[model samples]
Target: MNVQPPEAYATYKTYSAQLLAWDSSFSAFMSLKSHALTALQIRGAALLKIHHTTATIMGRCVPDPTDPRSIVTAANDPLIFSQSTNDFQTVVSLSQSLVAAAEQDIQRGNGRLAGGLTFSTDMGVVAPLYYVCIKCTDVPLREQAIELLGRCPRREGMWDSVLGVRMIREFWGMEEVHRQLRQGMVKLVLEDDGRWEWSWRDLHNGGEGGGVGYGVKEMLESQI
Candidate 1:
């Protein structure tokens, strides 16, 4: 449930209906819904996963000034899995902070790290979506988000990542982006190049300077 603290979850649950209320106003505005994953949602999720991973990695490593140990290590130190009183709190806090950092890093030019507008080194890079677009601006994304705000035809249908990829290709004319999302497509340039999923995983693991994607080096060179 997004790694929130126990209390936060309880509090969040109190307003659960309000938190995700999709009434007539929403449905009226979102009449053009598709059964497939929209381009924005698909790319957004993939990028979100990357950003979440980055936040978790960075947040855990943000040494507690009061304590010498890192959060993850500290969490593991107290007990097998946070049986200690303060251990769990620290873990939960760091997780929440990382998530916030990731969101700020993406939606705005957060100064805490290499913001959306900056080309931070791999180690300092937080979110890849900002870096991926190279042309990402706040206004367009905000509008896009508001436009896509609606329940999918079904929850499980959202897993098909190719929908948004196709949309990206069709609307934005991003052929390579579509190719990357559709892992099964054979590489036009390399005979031995298998599915994009393997290459993407390799790129993801390599972290920064693994530069080279869709004929654009800057697009995919993220810190994490």
Candidate 2:
């Protein structure tokens, strides 16, 4: 839990590589224990591999504080954003696979639980899907992830998928407003005391007017 960033990155990378090797060996091993293992178990292994892959990609976003050469901040780091987008794509695929496998189990009456609620002490899909919603550059992929979250009424320890969906939706709205502000479709007004307020440009009204809003600075700062 107290691992240094570099060590954590290396550990995640090792986990990803080892999972790949294990996957390659699974066919031969399954031949001997095909009856012993269920399809869900196989899919679970794949889900674990996806988690490791996600961690490895996330690790790349952490800059080493001790390295002077690692001076590029995340705000301007193209590599970090690119890796995040890749992570989103990978997570979405694995999530779909896992959902399909679970649905199959339900149809065959192998599903363990009943009703719309599920509880698990272990970490589950919510966190990664939430990450995709916030970090992924692709709007459609982010929306897809949110849609997936909405389908599951579950709790993985402290994570609530329903709450996550609400938060992501709010985040999307905020991001759209920020985009509009950047494009000058919305305008921010600086008060005399250095506080920032915002208003719509009122393009239809033919005047630089709208109801003034407070906390614009706070909203912009949160994004930073």
Using TM-score as the measure, the top candidate is: 2
lDDT of 1 by residue, 38-67 (tens): 644533433344444333333332233355
**TM per candidate:** 0.18, 0.66
Pairs of residues clashing in candidate 1? 38-164, 39-164, 122-223
* Model 2, residue pairs in steric clash: none
Across residues 23-98, which tens digit of lDDT does each residue of candidate 2 receive?
5676567678767877667666666756766665565665544544534454335457665776678888888777
Clashes of each: 3, 0
Best by lDDT: 2
Question: Which parts of model 2 are misplaced by more than 4 Å?
Answer: 1-37, 64-79, 104-109, 113-117, 189-197, 202-224
